[model samples]
Target: MPEYTTGKPWRLSAFPPLLWAVALLLTLSLAYAAQSGATYILIDDNLDTELAPPYALLQEGKALDYRSTTRVDRLMNGLPRNALRPGLQPLVGLMALFPPLEAYLLHELLVRLAGLLGMYLLLRRYGLPGPRLAALCAGLALAWAVLPAYTAYGVSVLGQPWVALALLNLRRGPGRWSDWLVLVVFAFWSSLVLAGMFVLAAAGLLLLRDTWRHRRIAWRPVLGLLVLGISYGVVEYPLVYSLLVKRQFVPHRLEFDYARLAPGGVGVGLASAGRYLLLGQYHAGLFLRAAPLLAAGLALAYAPAGAARRRLLRKLLAGVGVLVGVALFCGFYPQLIGVVQQTVPPLRAFNLSRFHFLTPLLWFGVLAFSLRHLPGPGLRAALVGLQLLLGLGMNTEWTLNVRRLLGRLPATEPTYAAYVAPELFRRIRQDVEARTGQQPARYRVACLGFAPAVASLNGFYTLDAYQNNYPLAYKHQFRELIAGELARSPELRTYFDAWGNRCYLFSAELGKNFRVAALPERAVAHWAFDARSFRRLGGRYVLSAARLLHPEASNLRLLGEYAAPGAYWHIWLYEVR
Candidate 1:
């Protein structure tokens, strides 16, 4: 057994298991309440396109045809076959067992519970003891449960707890061969982009610190970790290369506006950091309110003399160092951003604000560690109680805010709900089936002005898609097709952003010639409603909200119109002859 150095064993009695149970129950209750009377499948942002097809396939017990039906396939012309992380496939498979909504809820609940458990284990590994440890665990579990950062529709939330678990194990060092194996597996299974980056950052920092302290680099463990990371990469090389190299999907980029960078960018970044660290979101007043208490705690904790003060300062600095480093990269250095982008394209998506997620964990860890060193037991207990109160308050606020937002969601029939009305999709499918007398795979649907993602939800083989990982060849082909007189030198029509991301604009002449208006955002060379192009792409139906000049084109027949309450525009369905 490890020797207890900080306190008497009596004071460090085993924390009651009931405390953990209560914390978990509270967290689950909050999570369930937040989603009450609402669909578990969140349809925000890219989630509409990303998960809908997978969910549909899972329901049908059909293998994921990543190349044929998904948005990636639609946009990229089936190149790079699979774009999703392999880690997420297992969860999707598991969720397929139950009804879609129930499956989603169950998955979400399990992930949240796992996160709480991981955090509890992490705190225990940090040598925290007794009621204080129990309180901290409960508080953190509750806080994390309600935190907005974890509620997003991406894999980041799923990856977070695993990342924490990996960090905990990494900090303790591998005890055996089995431990090493688990670490490697967990690291790889965590979200490739978010958790992978966290592991790299944390491991690098810890290594640097250890080397600096010992005055020599530890080669064996480092090499072992490197081997594990490399092995994981080797296994996932296809997916990695597809996204990083072929797709050039730059999710995050440095906000290097000269006006924003100079004079006030640092201050703004700092303020943003503080907001994220405290409230996990942007609210000027919340930061202002919490700043004094945080400042007082740090000042009081570090005021004492001796080695303890130095240690506390070092812990505080470690957390601050990460935040500061990210801020510098994000706002202070444009040239450095360019260099990093060129060398490490995968890390381009490492935005400064994301470090906010890590900051609270570090700060809480430091605060928990420093509590034992306070002047007296009473003061220590008081500080811990205060932290628990603060955590509860923050969690309550977050829960209420989320509930309020969720309450605003349109209360429609279960089938025709969320981002795209299911009723509309069903009608479209029926129409197509009636027209063809069978649901054929070759028949493609195209959405011109409406979001293309709706096609995926309805199980339509679509000709339009909105995705970051668009195929280079397809993009070039589409650009050339739309180039008209500039077909020989299409670069003249293409525009590249500051980051060299290419986007093609349609000239007024092309719009006049094609008779297309109100093109969807991020359209292929701003192409919309070209009957010839649609026919060539095997498109049988076109859905649009825009006004087309020749609505009664000889080859096109208007099928129906649809409009749902709270929807922005009327949907017009046309069958191409």
Candidate 2:
């Protein structure tokens, strides 16, 4: 391995002035669009439930109830009702400066820029210079910016670039006491950045190995890393307490099928990784699409280069190996997967496929390095042009998907408006306010068979909030209710995992009282509504998209009906007496 000069400042001097100008222009354009009320794409399950509450509290001029005001938080018994990543709190706090929609767009833009900068730094550290470095950085920035994954992923995707940045910083050992300070600070920051522990762990281990091989045992940096790890634990105390002390954390079952554990399973796992790496689209043509870039990158790696370049290539290859190995292990090994699920409750929620983010970074590095050795200047320029074109094409695909998912909303509309029609919510809020004289918080509303985030978006307190992390007490109560329902009605179909967590299929009887239209086959969970139980839990109103099919129960009185757009289901309101 070739040695790098320690203590070199992370500078942009190597990039051309024009590249900087273009980056600034792109950022400004994004900022302008956000300011103009562009509808953002946020399809992740917790995008609204987990993220919107704190921002809403901030907007209301209240201290961020770290235990968010959502129903999930209310049910939990913990110091910080929400498991907040300490590093990301500052970014979340920054969201208070703008409207929720604008805040989301701005945050996405900044993180994407950070990702681009990190990629540039990593390529620079790998010894790419001048126009080759510039071209590679631009290509990476464009490709990442256009990827469809971020549209559905929201802020969680920020972890990808953060991991890249951490890896880049790790490449250079501390030369000064201040460098040590920088490194330590970065370590702490990383802990709070993302929940994707696998990628972070892989990067940290690779860096440690590289450092050990390059220098005498650096106890100071090692100790700093240890301190950072401890600090992260301290910051995540609420989560730790919930999982270890309170035993409130429950691991979700893995999404993949474990039955195909042999050759077929292995093939499926590899194909799944390929899909994620290739942006989960254009699956049939993925290899064909990536062929040129892959060929050029492999050629560059094989060509003669300096010791430093070769070392960088080796490091990247090792990193990819670690990621791929871990992904396969999680994919094919059911027993191991079960163990991880049972032991690491927090990590169980992560989809193994997301680790594909790591592979692309290494591949992009290879592409960057290859650009320098691609025969003539003309050929290199052509490759760069091709990359840029590919990026544009990817971005176009992302835009179309966004439009399709969000309907007729302009790209400049607030995203919340698209998901929860502003007019419909306004009408509902207006009626509720008039009925209760403007204070909707006095009574909690239950959105039967609708996403709980809808209530949060419209500024109403709700009885239902969707999230994986719920209090043990709530889960217990829910399970008991499902159990009682099953015992009373033998015909009701339900499925329970080995863990005893149950998902009850919506029965005709259950559907008659509650809106169960458009739900999955086994849509009703242990937490599905029981009118008497909900009434005891302080639910005073129920808003549903489907009409109640059963005769009015003694407790539920139909209030009124509201029309919605032809594409949407009608809204029905009921007063839970």
Candidate 3:
């Protein structure tokens, strides 16, 4: 990789004034579209559940809870009855160490802003010619304008782009101390997968002899990074706790079973690799369509100035190596794949071609590096055309796949203004106050008839979708049914409480007639309880009476149905008591 930078220093002109105008337009367009539900539409639902809890949590101002405390207690005894714990994430606690809500919001913002910044960084890093950079930037804007995940992660915000920007500036100069601080912050808070990739890339650079020689070896920066990383790790006590104690490896059905490790694993590896490659057969087939461009770029490299040739080769090799490593690891290591699958639970829930993202980044980098050698305008135009054609022929399925991914998301019915009519949650809260005489306290609320979107709206604790398996249930009945089996067994609860959860947020219809001897003696006025319907869904009962309360009157009224457009399951929210 160090060898690749030996070319004539590519000088980038400031973006043309006209290009700035275009960039502005693209930004505004993307921002608007994102606000219009495009962002939610863009995520790869299967492998991208990272957005769900955060999105729900941010909207609700609360953390996850269980509908059935008995079920949860059976699952994890150490878990607090009603304290905010990090969601099913183990790698993210570092970021959340500072202030989970702030870090999470920052992460969301960074992903949103990365769209523009990624283009700018890519342009500045390679020193693309003004016109070319302008074109590329404009293209990126437009591409992302329609791209949903761009907004979903808040890419238009500051997250991914900030990292790229930090790297670019770091390469330009060590940068201000503030810059280092920000990078350290992002490293902890950003997607752990992306952070892991960055760590590997940095490791790769540190390994390169040329890099070690050309770059001053300083213990200070390294120490700074270490200190920062450690600080983050410490702060993310929840993550550290989980990693050190809670997380365990399990053989998910879809992923490879590494327990059968053998010396003949290469054949097994290749077969597994090919299966994933062929899984998204359409896009994978089209990815092959970039071969000609890769070839042509190589052809140009041969005649190129020796320095450029060597430089391009280094980048190519590193990119290829990393990509291959990612593929192989994902294919062969059941543990690695299982861990990633846990982060994006839906990937296991829905069988998707999780590797599709790699192809685009791989080809784009290769193609971008190759652009330096083109003879002139005609050649560059041809190269650009090839790229466009490749993109067009490429995965048109990203959008649809994103929707599919969103659909499979366990319906985390986080309360959002969008979930019900705007301000409806507030209105309901006011109504509760009017009827009940006491203002709601900082406590978890139960949605008697539906999933609680209350967390999203009232900024109070609420239940998780996994707690409502029966409401969202179709085929993945195993996790829930197994829990149900354990629910009735006191012996099982003793062992289950090790995981730190105890509540289950079930649709009232699912746990019908399940007796809860601990219903609060005092109920808030105006909240209704229909024993029949309550039993139909798992009956809504609080596990910890001191921490939970029910309404005296059954004025359970419709707040709003949770929004689940193109979603796989019905998600509704109701306000009771």
Candidate 4:
């Protein structure tokens, strides 16, 4: 909605030096980490969750398989390959071309680089023409590139600039081939459920407004947007097939009780709104909300002194208003939409509250427009410099890398090398084979004190995993094994039942800690597990990250306690005999 102007290309000077330097350093650090595989990569909801599926598909020789029924047996007892993310995606496709970590790193770098260039193009092509303004826009673009976004999510957040540029190009009569190309590739590179649907909705509104203003349908932009939508549908064929054609599998999302889970009272809703407006939603990666907020405040105060006039003030303020309105809407949506979901039932499966996914780009776009209006180069540079520092400070991955380099990484955290200890897992896999006298693929293992991703990533067939979507029935079945433990912990029970996306092995003793290494290595002394159900559900081994006091209490046989130097987890492999 920020692209409401027209302009000719203007030269940005060599550019905002600090941001580019920081961006380069972050890129080099990540590249080095990826290449060396000896430092921390983001773990929470990342390496242990999203990255597992594609890497598992790659590991299982199904990275390129696009069939609807193609199953990857490594996860949740052959979770329908469709249940895992589509391989037709650019990120997963990269896995086929390179090793997992390197591929992930390359994909991340490409997303940022594309964002940098795309934002530059959008700014230069719209308003913001002079050298200093253009340079500031470039700095804003670079700031966008390094905003701690989820790497595996591809271009969902960062690709918004490309989408905006492409649509704006189409609005100017019969656009270039480059515009169409951007949409097509963007369809493949970005997630439909994440930001695509919201983008389409917003674009539709914009198109409607344009038609009303000009007294004719903006058919070209509409047609271009259609191409974008259709491309996404094609790329997300598996999702379409699973939801529409495939009748047997039901997602656990349908069972979600928003009231019980999120508890969206007015107070909570306002808090959530404030967080999104000021700090930003955590998943898409909050960066420099302060930058945009501060820039808008300054621009408003200095509006009369605008060397460029009040049009800049109106444009940026419009953008800020959009952010505030959207944030409040998103914040209250869970509470407000519960009635609709309850009435429709099936509609509950679709997460309609993700409109905040559009905010990061919106925030940066606002920053760019605000920078353009600021009367002087010094003021603009100061704002840009403030943004550079804030973005750098908030980017946990970049700071984590620096800490890893300096040997001061927190004791609680594990490096990418230590987290996924190949040598240690290889030994554990061999030990399991030696003890069980069978390939890991033949028997499913459940992780106790750690993420199942650790085992699954190491090529073990896992009974449990951290996934976005899996069979509802499998979730119920998996719960039986953890039901005893769940009974003891109401919090864990509510967590698994009310919003059971995880469907992981929950423990009352460990209390929802997938990685228990950070805490004192306390034994799960009172684990009420159903080993009979576990083996019945095809579980043969339990790879405990910490020791279990009495294996006999749960009919488990401790095979061995394994440790590798520099590894985060000390696995206690147990057989469910």
Decide which is better by TM-score, 1 or 3.
1
Q: Provide the overall lDDT of each model, using Cα atoms, as 2-decimal numbers.
A: 0.48, 0.48, 0.38, 0.79
- The CA lDDT at 258 in model 4 is 69
Residue-wise C-alpha lDDT for candidate 3, range 1-577, written one tens digit per residue: 1122665454434345335534553443332222322232221221123333343433333334322231221111111322222343322332335333234334434443454455455555553555445565444433322222322222212244444444545556666676576556554443332232344344345435435686765444445455446644643444444345653222122232223222245677676655443232231223443533464455455556687667766766776665566556546654444456657654442222334333434444455556555455555546555554454344333333233345542233221222332343454456555755545443334433222332332343343322201111211222342354346544433322222112233222223221111222212222223433333333222221111232233333343332234322222233433
Tens digits of lDDT, candidate 2, 132-151: 45555555455544433342
The TM-score, computed over Cα atoms with residue i paired to residue i, of candidate 3 is 0.51
Best candidate, lDDT: 4
- Cα deviation of 489, candidate 3, in Å: 21
lDDT of 1 at 465: 50
Give the distance in Å from residue 253's predicted Cα in candidate 3 to where it truly belongs.
14
Tens digits of lDDT, candidate 1, 1-577: 2346677564323545435544555554564443423433333333445554455455344434433234334332332334443424444655566644455555556555555565566556553556545665555444444333332233344335444455445545644564456446554444445445555666677778888999987665576557557755754565565555764332312222222222354576566545444454321111212432453365555567887677767766765565556544444443444456566654444443344435445555555555544454555555555654555455433344345456643232121133455665677678767877868355766665445555566566665554434444455544432344244233333221122122222333232122122223122332233566656656677776553455554256677876555343456777775
RMSD of each: 8.4, 8.2, 12.6, 5.2
Best by TM-score: 4
Query: What TM-score does each of the candidates earn?
Result: 0.68, 0.70, 0.51, 0.93
Query: Residue 563 of model 1: what lDDT?
Result: 59
